[model samples]
Each structure stands twice: as structure tokens, then as C-alpha cells.
Target: MNRVTAWLPDRIDRRVRVVAWLSFLAQTIIIATGGAVRLTGSGLGCPTWPLCTEGSLVTTPEMGIHGMIEFGNRLMTGVVGIVAVLVVLSIWRIRRERRDLWTLAVVVVLGIVAQAIVGGITVWTGLNPFIVGFHYVASLVLVCVTAAYLVRLDAVPGPRELAVPSWYAGLTHATTAVLAVSIVFGVLTTASGPHSGDADAGRTGYNAELLEHVHAWPGYALFVLTLVLLVGASRLRLPVRRWVVVLLLVEVVQIAVGLYQARNGLPPLAVGVHMVLAALTAATMTVLVLKLKRPTATAAPAGDAAVAASAR
Candidate 1:
């Protein structure tokens, strides 16, 4: 079994881990629900900033189920945000000189704030496709950061310094590119797609057919690139290869969801799945890249079996 992280007190570490895991899960759910809000043409479900239909948190019954669903998502985001804060505080209390842990916790808090702002911008801009797309991307990035932090805490002990080879470094760069392109296409798909609420309420002025065309081509490209990355990773020996494999699988799953979304009218379930997969893909890639750095060990001279055996 993998050793438990030493970054927390024994009495509290289990609880902290649970909170961290739940925070990650909750973030995934929020991303998925956000996709549903877009797919169902319900972006304007609330119909007012910080309020649903010029009413309190709970308003008139006529606001309908969509309003409740979207608001529920927001509520969950708040819950996840609180968990993130608690995780940070617990880390600080348990570990001495855990600068990495502290840094990530701060990042988690910042991501929550950024997500909230982007959400407000989406609403304020009346669901402008560009800003809406950005909002979704931000959520994925935030999730990626949170997941990377978690993985670092869970990784096996190794040199404190990065010790990856140049080839692995190249793979990391390529994977990052793949991640960025996939996210862009995902955003494009969401921007051109329908929103929650009335059919015409949140429509973007861009030609839906043209946007679909744009989104589809990149989707194919991203899928291809992701496959290439997996193949390329096979040629390099890297500590993060397992995570890279996980990343590729996540991308493949996302590709399936994208295809399903295109065939069907962006069903709530499919969109939610797409959103979660996208975030997972991003998180996996982030962990892979963060593991990369110049090799700290000098390469052994060729045919030095005796020395190698001794070192081993």
C-alpha cells in the first residue's frame, strides 16, 4: 500500500484527505452541472445577477426547475470552496515548512474567487459566448491545480529535485499543447451550443453551423493529438508515465462524450460527463508536466555493468 502523506497530523490527516477528495469531486460535479446549464439553454435561468428572476435565493414557483438546478450548482461551488479552505488550514496546522502545500492551498482559494468572478462576468455580459467559454476553461484550470496538488501529496518519495530526462521534458511540452487545444475546442463547442432557459434567450449571434464546424474539426485534432501523445510517452521512461496514461484515457473518454454530444442534442447527462472528463484530462496533464525537469542524476557511462550493479 502507498504510504500515507506525512503532511498532516495522524488524528486529522484522514479527515483532511476526505475533505480534499470531496472538494475535488464537488468541483467535478460543478463543472458538469455548468455544462448542463449551457447545454439546456438555461444560462439565463436565474435571469438576474446574484438572484433568480429578480427574487431572493428562493423565488416564485414560476422560475421553474432549470433555475433550481443552476442555483443548486452555485450552491455546490460554495460548498467546495469551503472545503478547499479547510484543507489549506489543516495542512498549515499539521506540517512545518510545507511551503508547497501552503502555496497550493492559496491557489485553491484563488481559483474559487476567480471562478465566482468569471461566473458573474458571464451573467453580466448576458452570456457572451467568449466570456462564457472562458468561464468553463477557468473551472477546468482550477480543477487541474487542485488535482495536481493532491497528486503531489500522494506521490511516492523521490528526490526533492526533478530528475526527468530531456525526452520526457519534450513529452510534457507536447502534452501541455494537447491539453490547451482540447480545452479551446471544448470551449468553442459550448460557446456555439444552446443555453438554458428559453430557446432564443442565450443564443450567440455567430452562425451555429459555422461554430459547430469550427468546434468539430478541433475536436478531431485534439483526439488525434492526444493519441499521438500517448504513443510518444511510450518511448520515454518517466516517473509520471502512469499519470500520463490516465490523462490519455480521460481524453479518450472525453472524445466519446464529444461524439455523443454531437449526435444527440447536448443532453444534460452527456454535457455533465463531458465537463467532468475535460477537467480530469486537464488535471492529469497538469500533474504530468509538473513532474518534468532537468535530470538531476548524471548518466552512467555505456557498458558500465559493474558500476551500475553496485549502485543498484
Candidate 2:
């Protein structure tokens, strides 16, 4: 065990950074592939949980393209699991010294397992819209955690202090709240729209049009707030400046795709892009939140993160 521990790096190295990035990238890829499964109407292509179908561990020739798409997404989960495991092992030696990285790695693994079960439930429940929405929210959360790990990877091992003004921090947090609200409403909007994973899966019995407008309200609010943040960040030269800019750009593309899909008969391709962008938006926001604080290098007390600016 000592030899094994010795083999692991005591600090973040290229390998550690690679694995950290892979963890986040894999999470994002899975979301995109999951979007493919839904947009392609293959949510039930497997037709059962823990198995592709009765007495078969994979999709059969008889299942056709839908099965392949759904099964492909499932296979991607295995890829995600493998990457997550690598993350845990890669940081095993440093777990004691870097509890934040260790904890986030464990969370990624647990989140993947939870996602698999929730995915099965989506199948069992006939793709219940609410459950599906929750599943999506759960995945976004995993993306956020992985993104946070990447941020914390470079943090100094000590307590943190807000680098921005108190009011700026409060506005930043409120923007995060608006972002969450936007996502919730967007999920609801999709739940009642034409795309519910499967044709026969039906919808959440709400007004799709109304929910679209409701979703846009928060989206617009988030955009305005982010604009304000970007202006302040540019002037203050805050650490979070670049990432808030990223968040704003993502929102722009997201809103564009959303509008295009809404007006263009809800094209599956556009919808899939929108979904992936949403995950990216959430991930970017996670980075922004982490940047609100800087490591107090000389603090008597310990903390979770370190100097993360260059790591991004």
C-alpha cells in the first residue's frame, strides 16, 4: 500500500489534470448523447432496465436504429463510469491531503450510479415528464460537480475569502438562482412540448406555449444579470471575469437555439444542441461560483480549494 501510494503524485500533475478534465468532458458527452437518445425518440428503445431487452445484454438486430441510439447512450454511461473510477484512483494518494478532490470524485461516481437508476425509472414510468426532468437536473448537477473539481484542482489548500465585493457576490448568487429557475422552466417547457423522449410517452399535461414564455422570463433575467456581472468583472478585473463571459456566450447560443427550435417546429437537432448548451451553461456557472473566493494562503484554518485561475 505504501508503494502504491508512493506511485501516485502528491500534487496535481499532467495526469491528474488530464483525468480531471476527462471527468468533466465525459459528463458533458454523456449529456449530449442522452440528448440524442431523447431527440431520436429512443427513450424506450431498450424496452427494459438493466438489460437491453429480455434475455439479451445488448441491442439485437431486430431492435433497429432506435435501440442502437438508446443502447449507445447506455454504453456511454459505462464510459463515464470508467473515467470516474480513474479519477478516484488517480487521486487516491492525495485524498487525505485533498479532501475536496476526493469528495468530488466520489460524488461523480455516486451521481452516475444514481443516474442509471433514475434512467431505469424513466423507462419503468413510461418516461414520466417530471421524472425525466429530475433526471436531467441530476445530470446537470453531476456536470457541475465535475466542473467544480477542475476548479478546485489548482486551489491552495486553505480557507477561502470572497475576492469580489459583497454586493457583487450577492448578485452573482442571485444570477445563479435565476439560472436554476430558467432551467426548471425550460425542462417544464420541453415536458409539455412535442418532444417527450417517445411519441407514445405523452406529455406532462401543461401548456407548452405558456411554459415556453415562462422559461424565457428567467432566461432573459439571467442574461441581464450576467451582462451586469461581465461589466463589473471587466472593470474590477475579477478572477471570475472570463468565466462569466463564457456563461454569457453560452446563454446567447442557448437562447438562439431555443428560439429557433420553438419557431422552426421544434427541430430535434436544435433541441439536442440546446440541451447540451444548457449543461455547458450550468458547468460554466459552477466555475463562476468557485471563482467568487480566493484561497487565503496564510489562514490558520484549512479549506477545500486552491489557486485555480490558470487551471482553467
Candidate 3:
């Protein structure tokens, strides 16, 4: 049989790369628009799901600006879904040959579906803080997945081996764990804060001040851990140095934004920036962690091999 990729885009081909970038970009933008939705008290702009409201698929005039914002977000979701579906279909030629790429492609599309379901849950619960927090966390998870897919796109398909010393690997894992803790606390802190997506949404009973410190401690700790990773990467001359540096830069800005909002009564604009930076931080960290390994070696991709044999 002929090579399928002769007519279809390969894993790292221009079309696939563009679609992947769109997937990543869409995930990032949704977070920003989503923050706008919550901060502007338009979470319920449509006031119902699957139909926006009972028997109505679109926002009504009564919903006003809130309706528009929410409808815009829903439209964005459609965009994300279409892009995600494209990613999966684009790699059909290599789906069996390049499990790494196709698997991620599949996961991302499925994640978009799962996220849509979670979004519905957020509405059904009347923006319950815990459910809302879970919803944000789920979106962050998808961001991480999309970030990972983007990073892997730069590498060849093959088995991978640890490319660093054992201790260094341990440090990276620890760093990731610390980052997780920081993010979890940050979510809890937000749940306890004034921004609850809607005026009727209830907040957690925790004291915002105390939870803020709880969140800050882990964040500060994460920064320190990242510094250690950066230093180690520098001393060892590891290939991951650039990724670590990028992760550090994101952390710096994130922390500055966090501090500004903590003192300024958590203005909606600053808070939205903080949310965006947090996603960036998570995404960059994901890239760094992936950089820890390299393909043990490279071989001809299945499509290329097939084409060469066919020519012979």
C-alpha cells in the first residue's frame, strides 16, 4: 500500500503544527475570556445550559452585556472543539505508527468534550465554589495537555530515556509537585475571594486573608524550587536550561501580579491577568518537565519508511 501521509499531514508537518498552535492558543485564550466572564459577573449571562436558557439557544436582550459575554464564550468553545477535532483527524495517516502524537491528539479532542460537560456542571450547580474551582482546575489540566502535545511535536517518535542524572530528575519531579501544591492552594484562595462568577454564587467559608497566606507560601516555595532547577540546569549544561529559564520568567510575573492584587483588594483586571499567568506558568512548567527526556535514538518514521519501500 502507499504511504498515507503522502496525501495527509505528518505529525510535525506545517498543517499539524498550525492546528496544534491553534489548539494551544485557543486553550490559553479561553482562560482569559473565562476570567473575564467570572470577574464581570456574567457567568450566568445565559442562565441555562445546552440551550443557554430554557427553549432558547442564544442569549436574549434581557440578558444584556452578560448574555453577550457568555454567548461569546460559548462560541469560543465551538472554535476550540473544531480545532481539537481537526488535530485528531489530521494525523490519521500516522495514528498507528506514531502513538505519541495520535494519543495526545485523541486526548485533546476528548478533553474538549469533557470540558464542555464540566462547563455545564458549573451552571447546574449555581456556580458552587467547589465545583467552579474544579472547573477551573479541569481547564488548567487541558492546558497542560495541550502544552505537552505542542512540546512533543518538536521531537521525533521513538522510545525515550532519561537524559539527566537521577538526582536531577528527582529535583524536577519535586519541583512539579511543589507547583501542583501552589496551584491547588491558589484555586482554594480564589474560591474564598470576592469574585464568585455571579452575585448569587456562594463562596467557601474560609478566611480569604488566611487562605491567601496559605496560597502564597506554596507559591513562594515553588519559585524557590524553580530557582534550584534553573541553577542545576545551568551547572549541568542540560538541554532543558531554556525551558527552565522560561518557566522562571513566568513565575516572576505571576508573583508580581499576585502581590499587586493581594494588596489592591483583588481588582478584576489584575485578577484576570493573574489567572492567565497561572495558566502560562503551568504550561511552561509542563514543557520543562517534558524536556527532561530525549528520544533514545531516532529511526525513519513509518510514513517515510513506507514511501521509501514503495519506491524500491
Candidate 4:
């Protein structure tokens, strides 16, 4: 155990940050790829769980391109699992000291496991819109969590001090709330729309056009709220102003993509881009939240026993 500990860095460093970035990137990539699978009508190419097909661990020739795409997506889970294991082990020696790190690492791994099960279920249920929507939303949640983990890695431990006024914090919370509602409506819009993963896949039975408009309401609200936050941050010279700018940019681009998709009758490429931007927007929001506060305590250097103890 000591040798293993010695082999891995006992403290957070560039290598640790690299792993953290990889964790975030992996989730984002998976979201994009999953979008591809659905847009391409490859959701059920393999037609079975655990194995690509019944009694087969790989895609068969008859399954064609769809099978390859779906199987490729399944294989990505293994890649993500490997990265999660690395993240856990890399920080194991400091697990007691950096409880936050190890705990989040475990959650990332467990979340992946749960996602795999959900994927299987989605396939088994013949891509029911609700379950499929849940699966997509779950991926966004994982992206958000991973983004938080990354932010925390660089943060000093202890209660964070607010960088902006208390009301600004409240505004931030409200923005997050509206963002959540918008995401839910967006998911519903997709569930009721034309891209049902498979040809015979069940839809949510709601009017897609109506859901689209409902989704836009909260989205516009988010944009206006975020604009207010940005102007306020800039005037106050708040450190989070930069992130707010980023958030606004993402929101604008996402809105554009969404508009294009709708106007074009929901082209697959536009939908895929919208999905990617949605994940990116979620990550950016997490960053904005973290940026709203500064750590109250100074972070100790990597090998300090006092730091280790405090982290515990």
C-alpha cells in the first residue's frame, strides 16, 4: 500500500488536475455521443443489454452501422469507468485527509455504474420517451457534479465567503432554479418531438410545439436574469463577472442553436449541437456558482500534515 501511495502523488498537483479535467471531458463527450446515437436512430442497434446482442458480446455484421454506433457508445462507458477508477486510486492515500476528493471520486464512479444500468433499461423498454429523457437528464446531472468536483479541487476548504452581495447570491440561486425548469421543459420538448431514438419508440404524447414554447419561456427568463446578474457583477467589480459573461455567451449560442433547430424542423445536426451546448451551459452555470464565493481559508501546500488533518 505504501508503494502504491508512493507511486501516485499524495497531493493535488498538475497530474491530479489532469485527471479531474479528463473526468469532466469524458462526461461531456459521452453526452455528445449519446446524442449521436439517438439522432442516428441507433439506440437499439444492439437490441440487448450487457451484451451487444443475445449471446454475443460484440456487434454482429447484420447489425450494420447502427450496431457499431451503439456498441461504440457502450464501450465509452468502459473508458469513463477506467478514468473514474484512476481518479479514486490517485487520491486514495489522501482519502482520509481529502474526504471531499475521495467522496466525489466515488460518486463519479457510482454515477457511471448507475448510468449504465439506466442505459440498459432504456434499451430494454424500447426507448420509452420518459426513460430516455431521464437518461439524458441524468447525464447532464453527472456533468454538473463533475464540474463541481473540478471546482472544489482548486478551492480552499471551509465555508466559502460570498464575493458579491447577499442578494446577488439569492439572485444566483434564482437563476439556477429557472435554469432547472428550462432544462426540464427542454427535455420534455425533446421527448415529445420527432427524434424518438428508434422508429417505433414511444413519445411523451404531449404537443411538441406547445412544449417547445413552454421551454422557451423559462429559457428567456434565464437569459434576462443572467443579463441582470452580469450587469450587476460588472458594476460592482465582482470577480464572478467574467464567468457571468461566459454564461451569457453560452446561453446566447444555445438559444441560437435551439432556434435554428426549430426553424429547420429539428435537423439532426442542429439537435446534436443543442445537446452539446446544453451540457456546456450546465457546466458553465456550475462555474458561475462557484465563482460567486471565495474560500475563507487559505489552502495548505500538498504535503503538509496540518492541511491533511484539517481536510479530514
Candidate 5:
């Protein structure tokens, strides 16, 4: 144990920060690649789970562009998995001293495994719209978790200070709820729209136009709530004002993308950009929520702190 501790960094510093950012970027990149799979109608390129095909483990010359695209996206998952493992291993020595970071790192590794299973199920179900929607939501949830981990890293080795009022915390919670609803409705809209990943893929069988309007309502509510939150944060001189502004800007850009896509017939490029922004918005909201509350202290038993201090 002493040797392991000596091998790893004793403190959370530049190396840890770089790994955290890499983990976040890996998640973001996979979202974009996943979007490519759907936008290009390549969801079933491999046509088999745990393998590219019945006898092949990767794309072949006969599989065509669709096959290659889907297989490529699958390969990207390996990259994410590698990063997840690195993040977990990097924090092993400090696990007792910083359980929050260690726990999140482990969660990220497990989440990637679960995501792989979900991806396989999506393929087995023949690209069911509901299943695919759930898969996207799972990615967003992972993004939120990773973002929280990143923000919390900055407050380590000390007691966290509360940065916002009780009411502001409640407001942040409300904003998160509304944002979740909007994302669900947005997924529903896509499920009912023309993008079914493949020509034979099943859709939700609802009126796309109606779903679009429903999604827009929550988005509008989120916009108003964020605007109010921004004003309140500014008036109260909370540290989260910058994050609020960022969230508002992301919301405006997403709204514009949705409107333009609706008018322009849901072009692949527009939808792709919208998907990226959605991930960004989720990350921003996560950081904002984490920043509003006090940082969690390492809950050591009676003599653990003294032991840790001596070890350092």
C-alpha cells in the first residue's frame, strides 16, 4: 500500500485535472459520434452485438459506408472505456482521503459498462425509438455525473463553503427539473420525427409537430427560469452568476437551432450541432448545481485524519 501511494500523486494537482478533462471530453466526443451514427442511418451497420457481424469482428469491405460509420462509433466506445479506467486508477491511492472523488471515478467506470449493455440492447431491439431515446438520456446523465466530479475536485482538502442562499439552491433545483423535462420532450420529438436511424427503424408513432411544440414549451419555461435565476444571482452577488449566464447562452443557441431545424426540415448538420449543445448544457447545469452547495468533507472516523496527516 505504501508503494502504491508513493507511485501516485499525493495531492490533487495538474495531473488529476488533466485526467478529469479527458474523461469529460471522451464523453462529449462519443455523443457526437453517436449522433453521426443516427444522422447517417448507420445504427445497424454492424448488425450484431459484441461483434460487427455473424463471423466478423469489425467492418469489412462489403459492409459499405453505413457499416463503417456504425463500427467506428463502436470503436469510439473503447476510447471512452480506456479513459474511464485511467480515471479510476489515478485516484486509487487517495481513495480514503477523498472518497467523493474516488466514488465518482468508480461510478464513471461502471456507467460505461452499463452504457455498453444498453447499446447492445438497443441493437438487439432493432433500433426501437424509445430504447434509443433512453440511451441518449443515459449519456446525458453520465455527463452530469462527470461534471460534478470535475467541479468538486477544485474544493478538495478543505471544508466547502456555501456559495448561494437557500432560495437560490431551490431555484437551481427547479431549473434542473425543467431542463430534464425539456430533454425528455426533445427526445420524444426526435422519436416521432423522420430520423429513425434507419429506414426500417421503428418510430414512436406520434405527431412530430405536436411533440415539437410540447418540447418547446419546457424549453421556454427553462429559458424564463434561467433568466430569473441570473437576475437573482446577480442581485445577491452569488458566485454562480457566470454559470447562469453560460447556461442562458447555451439555451438561446439550442432554441435557435431547434427553430431553424424545424423550418429547414431537420437537416442532419443542424440536428448534430443541437445534440452537442444539449450535452454542453447538461454539463453546465451540473457544475452550476454543484457550485451552489457547500463542498462535502471527507467523513473520516476518529483518528483517520491524524493518520492521514501523518502519512502525508
Candidate 6:
């Protein structure tokens, strides 16, 4: 059997990689739609826990179109949950090569379920700022972990140890951490501060401008950090993969949209686009980091030297 086909189970014929890709795509859509719910001031449109107003999926006329929009986003979470299960099961059947991938998928599914419960609590408690903030943070974390899982699954056993500067790996780790923190700060701004013209109404706990400024500073720091990582990666002379380029472009677009939203008083459409781009950037970073091979700065054994010379 070929190397790619060797990863499959005898009982299952189709590629597990395809399922993994579909799960990633589904996850991206679900994250984007969830952001839409918050951006459009529909976070509380349902106005009840685990249901729309009055415990109906579609309540009375007073619930209106906004309520339906929110509920529909909620429904999309179920689709993500289904895809997560499929990914997990497909990997489990072929557990020999990629146990970690399946394990992370299992964790992601649990995280999403817990995230849904948190969403419910946010509504039940009248959209308490702290809980809502965590809800958004949780989604970002899920994307990060899920992306890492997907990338590792697709990884080939190339050379067992490709040579790259140790500092590049460190920078990648730092960049990923900063991006995650930036995402949390974003959630804080949206949850605690006024946004979408709802701040004055006391929907969230903090004032709009103050919370926004607090959130904005982290983004500036994160942008600089990402640049450092990117430059350092380029210096290593390791092959730059397609995903890294795509991720950097997405990050640039996300930053641009964020700046526009800030200047335009947080337009809903702009914020929604920013959220999707942020998720994509986060996912792509995960892929890039996973692809990186840290240099040990040690001489190779005779067997390894022979293979390396032959490949060159």
C-alpha cells in the first residue's frame, strides 16, 4: 500500500482526511454565524435559555425576525456538533496513526457543547457581561484546538525531524498565544462595553469607549507580535507553506476591518467580517505552527546523514 493509503483502516475505504477537511469548513461557518448573532444585537433576541422567547423555537410575533435570526444561528451549532462527531469516529476507526487527532476532536466537541450551555446561561442571566465574554473566548479556543488537530492529522512523517531554527518555534508559540489573548480582549470589549449602539442601555456592564480602548491596545501589540513571528519564520529559510501566506493575508485583512470598524463606530457588517477573518487567521496560525520543526542544534547520526545527503 502507498504511504497515504497506509493510514486507513481495512474496514473503511474512503479517506478520513476528507472528513477532517469538511469538519474544519463546517467549524468556520459555525463560528462566523455565531459572531453574526452578537454583531447584530441578537445575542439576547431569543430572551430565554435554550429556547426563544416563551420557550418556543419560534415564538410570538413580538419575538420577530431578530429572534428567528438568533435561533437559526443557535441551530447551526448542532450542525457543527454533528461534524465533530463524524471526524472523531472516522479517526477512531483508524486509531493507529493519529490518536491525538481523534482525541482533540473529542475535546472540541465537548468544548462546543459546554460553549452552548454557556450561551444559554448568558441568555438566562440576562446576558451577564462576564459569562458572555467567556462564551466568545471559548469559541476562539475551540477553533485554535480544532485547527491544530486538523493540521496534525494531515502531517506527513517527513524526515522525522526537519531542520528549522528553535527561535522560529518559540516565536510561533508566542504569536499563537498573543492571538488567543487578543481574541479574549475582543470578547471583553464586545461583552462588557457598549457596542452596536446598545452600550447606553446598560446591556453590558462597561462604557463603550473606555472598554473599546482597553481592548484596542492588545490588538496593536498582537499585530507587532505576529509580524515578528512572520519575519523570524522567513529568516529560517524553511519552505514557506501556502497556509502561512493565507493566514498572514487573513490577519492583515482582519486588522484592516478592525480599524475600519473602530473608526466607523463598530458597524455590524464590519465586525462580523472581522470575526470570521480572526477565526481563519487563528486556524491558519495553528497549521503553520504545527508544520514547524524545531532545530535541536545537534549533529546527525551516520544513518540520518546518509538519508539527508541523498535527499539533497
Which candidate leads the pack in lDDT?
2
Every model's TM-score: 0.79, 0.94, 0.93, 0.94, 0.92, 0.80
What order do you get sorting by lDDT, best first?
2, 4, 5, 3, 6, 1
TM-score of 2: 0.94
In terms of lDDT, the poorest run of 10 residues in model 2 is: 301-310
Lowest lDDT 10-mer window, candidate 1?
294-303
Q: Write the per-residue lDDT of candidate 6 for residues 1-312, one digit (tens) a residue.
A: 475355544322345567767777777777777777766677777878676766576645786766767888788888888888777767665555445665788888898789889878877776666776677667877877878876665344223454456766676677777777777777767765444322322455557677667766767776777666667556655664455566667877887898899898777788778777777877787777767753233423543453343345
Per-residue CA lDDT of candidate 1, range 136-220, in tens? 7888877877787676564332234555666657756765785687578656656666653346545456666566666666556
lDDT of 2 by residue, 21-54 (tens): 9989999998899888888899999999889999
Steric overlap count per candidate: 7, 5, 0, 0, 0, 0
Query: What TM value does model 6 have?
Result: 0.80
Winner by lDDT between candidate 4 and candidate 3: 4
RMSD (CA, angstroms), candidate 2: 2.9
Better of 1 and 3 by lDDT: 3
So what's the TM-score on candidate 3? Answer: 0.93
Comparing 3 and 4 on TM-score, the stronger one: 4
Residue 4, model 1: lDDT of 38
Candidate 3: C-alpha lDDT: 0.86
Instruction: Please give, for residues 1-312, the per-residue lDDT of candidate 5 as tens digits.
Output: 878668776666667778888999989889999999999999898899989999999998888999999999999999999988878777777778778889899898899999999999999999999999998988888888888889867553455556788888998999999999999999999989998899999999999999999999999999999999999999988889999999999999999998999999999989989988898999999989888865444523323454455346
- lDDT against the true structure, per candidate, is 0.68, 0.89, 0.86, 0.88, 0.87, 0.69
In candidate 4, what are the lDDT values of residues 101-194, reduced to their tens digit? Answer: 7888999899999999999999999998999889999999889888988987866655557878999999999999999999999999999999
Candidate 3 lDDT by residue in tens digits, 1-312: 356547676445778788888999998899888888899999999888988889789988888999999889988999989999888877777688768878888888888888888889889888899988887887888889999998877665666778788898889889888888988889999999999989999999999899999999989988999899889999999999999999999999999999999999999999999988988899998898888887664543653454454345
Better of 2 and 3 by TM-score: 2
